[model samples]
Target: MTEHSEHGTQFVSKKYTSWPAMTEDINGGTLHAAFILAPLAMVMAREGDVPVKIVHLGHRDGTAIVVRKDSPYESFADLRGTEMAIPHRYANQRILIEKLKEDFGFGDDEITLIDFNPPEMPAALEAGQFESYIVGEPFAAKAEVDGFGRVLYFTKDIWPKFISCVLIVTQELIDTDPELVAELVQGISASGKWLDEGDERLMAGVHREGHIPVDPGRGAQVIIPDGFGTSPRMQAAMIASQRQYYNQDPELLKWVLSRPPDRVRYTELALARDEMEEIQRYAERLGFFSRRPVTAEDPFGFDDYCDPSFAESGRRPLPLQPADGQ
Candidate 1:
C-alpha cells in the first residue's frame, strides 16, 4: 500500500503476480515504477488510460514459444487448431500469434487460447492441458529441463530485435521529482546489466539459492542478455504490434491517436522519433493498422515522454565478483 514520494529515501513496493495485476496496482496508486511488458505499458499510457509512461527498457529478447516434447508440430503452420497457453492478451505472446496468422494463415479460431500465468504454464503443458505455450524465460527453460517441452520459436527470429519488459512510472512522478526517477532507472539498468553478465555459474548459483532448485546449466539456458535503452525501434515494434492486437475498435484508436504525446523522461536516452515513425510506416505497410486509427497524431511521437535527464546522469551496471566460488 506504500507509494513513492519525491523526497523519500527508499523505494518499497508490494509484489504483484501478473501483468494485469501490476497494471491495476499502478493505476490504483499503489506502486510507482514497475517492470512491465513494453507494449502493454504504452497501450495503457495511450489516451491517458493510465497516468504512466515508459522510462527505460527492462529486458530484451527473452521470449519463446514452447511445444510439448512429444508433439508432432514443427512450425507455426503445423500447430493450427491446437490448444495454446499465453500469459495474457497484453503480453508479447499475442504478437507472435498475430505473426503466425499473417505468415501461415493460422486463424484466431484455429488455436484455442488458454490463459495462465507464466509460472503455471509449464505444469499446465506437462499435464496435457495445452499442446503448446508461449512465455518469457525460466518457465520456458523449466519445461526444457523437465523434459516435457521443446522450444519452437524465439520471437526475436520474427521481429528485428524487440524488447520484452520496460520500466514505467506515473506522469506525476516525472513532473514533480526528476531525481528520484533517475535513481530508479539507474538501479534497474544496473540490475539488468548484472543479469546480462557472462559469469553463468554465479547467476546460476544465485538462481538455485533464491527460488527454483534447478542446476546451473538449466539456469544458464533461460538467461538472455537484456539491453537497456530507449531505442525508437523498440518503441515502434511494441506500439505497432499492440495497435494491431487491439484493432477491434476504431474509436479507441482515434481517441488514443488524437491525444498529445506525454512528456516522457529518461536518464541516458532520448526518444527516437524518426526510427519510431519509420517503424510505424513499415508496420502500416504490413497491415498492422488496417483501420488507420489517427491520421494526425502519431502514437510514436513520444516527445512528451522524452525527458532523459535522469538517464543521462545515472550510472550503468558494473561487473560484479563471481558467486558460488567460481
Candidate 2:
C-alpha cells in the first residue's frame, strides 16, 4: 500500500506487484503489467494511457453478443436502441465501447452501463437485466450451456480478427528492475509460444493452473474465447477494423498511421518496452518500437525506473487528436 510520485506520474511499486496482490490493491491484476509480458502490449497502446514499457499478456480471445435464450430480441441488430449490459471502467472494454458508439451510433447514455462488472454480465443478461450483453469467454459459453442464450455476433464478425488487451507495470519497475522486467517479458513471450506449440493436455494444465479462474473447456477457452497464439497479422486487421470507430476511413491506414485520442505509443510503461531487446526489434518495425538505447541485459537499467521521486509534478494527459482530417 505504498505510493510515490515519480516523473509526473504516480509511481506505485504496486504496478509490479504479483497477480492476486496486484488485483487486490487495484481491482485485481485487472490493471497489472506483470501479467502480460509481450506482443499483446503493443496492441493495448491503441489506448492513450498505456505505458511505453508495457508487457502484454495476450489478446482478447474474441467478443460475443448475446440475448437471453428466450428474449424477444434475437439478433445483433436488435442491440440498436436496446439496453446492452457491460462492466464499465475495464480497460479492455474501452475500444469496443468506442466502436459501438461509432458503428451503431450508441453512446453511454443510450445503453445501460451496468455496474455488475464482467463476471456478472452473463448472469445479469439472463436475469433480464438487459436485452443483450457484451461479453467474453467462459461467461458467454456458460450462458449457452445453461440454455440462457446463444452468440448473436462475435468480435471476429463485428470488430477485427485479432485484438490485443495488455497488462502493464509502471516504468519505475522497468527502471528499478530491468533484469526482472526482462524475465517477466521473456516469460510472457515464451508462454505464448508454449501455448501455441504445447499439447492440449499442457494447455489444459496451463488454463487450469494459470491466472484465469474458469475452466478453459467449460465452453470458455475451448469455445475460442481464450486464444493461445499471438498473431501479428491479427493486430493489423484489428486496427483496420477499428478505423470506423475513430471515424477514420479504413483505407486511410495504408496512407497514414492511426490518429487516436492517445498518441498510440508507449504512454503507460515507465521505460517503454520498445527499448527492450528482441521485442524492440520485432515491434519497432510496426512503429511501436522506440529508438532509445534498448538492451536485453536489464529492463530496469534506467535510473528513474520505480524511483517515483518526481511523480508529483502533475503531468497533463497526452494530447491526442484525430489524425489529419479524419
Candidate 3:
C-alpha cells in the first residue's frame, strides 16, 4: 500500500487511493459520495455524465415498510387509508410509500406522508407513534427481529432493484485517469468481493475502524456490484419515473443517454407505456403532476447538472466510483 499523506494511502499499483479516514476530501474531492434516498433517483440524476465511472457499493439495496409483526394491516393492501408515516420528503421511503398507495389506486392524497429521520421512525414505530414508515436494511431486519413490525414489503422487490448509494466523480477525473478509473473499477469489484466474503473480522480491528455499517451477518444482505455500471434495461424506467420526481425538472432521457455506459441494455418506453402510466399517475397522486406530459419542462434535464464536461470522443459513464482500496 502506498501512503499519500499520513492520513490517506494510495494503492499506486491499482492507480487509486484508500481514503484512510472518511474526510471532507472524499465528498468535496474526487472521492465525493452521496447517501441516496432513492436508487432510481440516482439513475435519473447521473444520466448523462459517462466517462466518469460510478461506484454502486451494492449496500443500501433499498427499504420497505414494516409494522409490528402482529399489526392488523398484514400486507401493503392493509396500508390503504391508514395514516402511514415516513422520514422526510423525496426519499426512497417517501417514494415507495407513495408507490404502495398508487399501486393500490390511491394517490398521495389518499395516505399521509410523515417526516422524521432515522432512529425516530424505528424508535417511534416501536412505540406506535405512527402506523409505519420507510426503513432500511439491518434496521429493517433489526425491527422485524426486535418485534417492532412485520414487513409490509421489501421495496427492492417492487422494481428491478437498481443499485443505490453511488460514489460519483467529475468527468475531469475520468479524462485524466481513465486507467486509474479502470483499476478503481477492478478494486471496487475486489472490495465488493471482500465485503461479500467477510474476510475481515467482524468488528475486531481495521474493518471496525473502517466505518463500515454492516456486520458479517448483515453484509450478506448488502450488495457490492463490481462497478457503478447500470443495466440499459433499467434506464428507460429510471428516466421516466425520474422525470416526475419534481426535484429538478425532467430532462430528455436521450440527451442524458447521449454518452452512457460503453456497454448497456436498452428498452423503449413504448413497450413500457402501461408501467410508465402507473408511475406517472402515482406521481400525480403525490401532486407531482395532474397528468403526465408528453414532453418534460427541461427536455435536456440530464446535461443541465454538469460541473464541467470532460466531453470525450465516446461514452462517459458517471454513475459512481469508490477510492482504490476502499
Clashes of each: 17, 32, 21
Badly placed stretches (over 4 Å) of model 1 are 1-13, 47-49, 197-300, 304-309, 316-326
User: Which portions of model 2 show Cα errors greater than 4 Å?
Assistant: 1-53, 105-109, 161-164, 199-326
Candidate closest to the true structure, highest TM-score: 1
Which structure among the candidates has the greatest lDDT?
1
- The runs of at least 3 residues in candidate 3 whose Cα sits more than 4 Å from the true structure, single-residue gaps closed, are 1-31, 38-57, 60-62, 160-163, 170-184, 193-297, 301-326
The C-alpha TM-scores of every prediction are: 0.64, 0.47, 0.49
Give the Cα lDDT of each candidate.
0.56, 0.40, 0.40
Error of 3 at 199 (Å): 8.6
Q: What digit string (tens of lDDT, one per residue) describes model 1 on residues 76-174? A: 888788888987665556665766777887665888877789878999899999899988765666687677888887665666345556678888888
- Candidate 1 lands at a TM-score of 0.64
lDDT of 3: 0.40
Is candidate 1 or 3 superior in TM-score? 1
Estimate, for each residue in 1-326, the C-alpha lDDT of model 3 and write its tens digit.
11111222233221121122222333345443322333232333334223323332324334556687667987677766666666445344565665566677886566676766554566678887777776554344446555556666665466444222334444566667655544444444433333333232221111212344454321111122233222321222132223222122122222222222211112110112233334434433454322322246533222322221222222222222233323
The alpha-carbon deviation from the true structure for residue 226 of candidate 3, after best TM-score superposition, in angstroms, is: 30
At residue 279, what lDDT does model 1 achieve?
Answer: 37
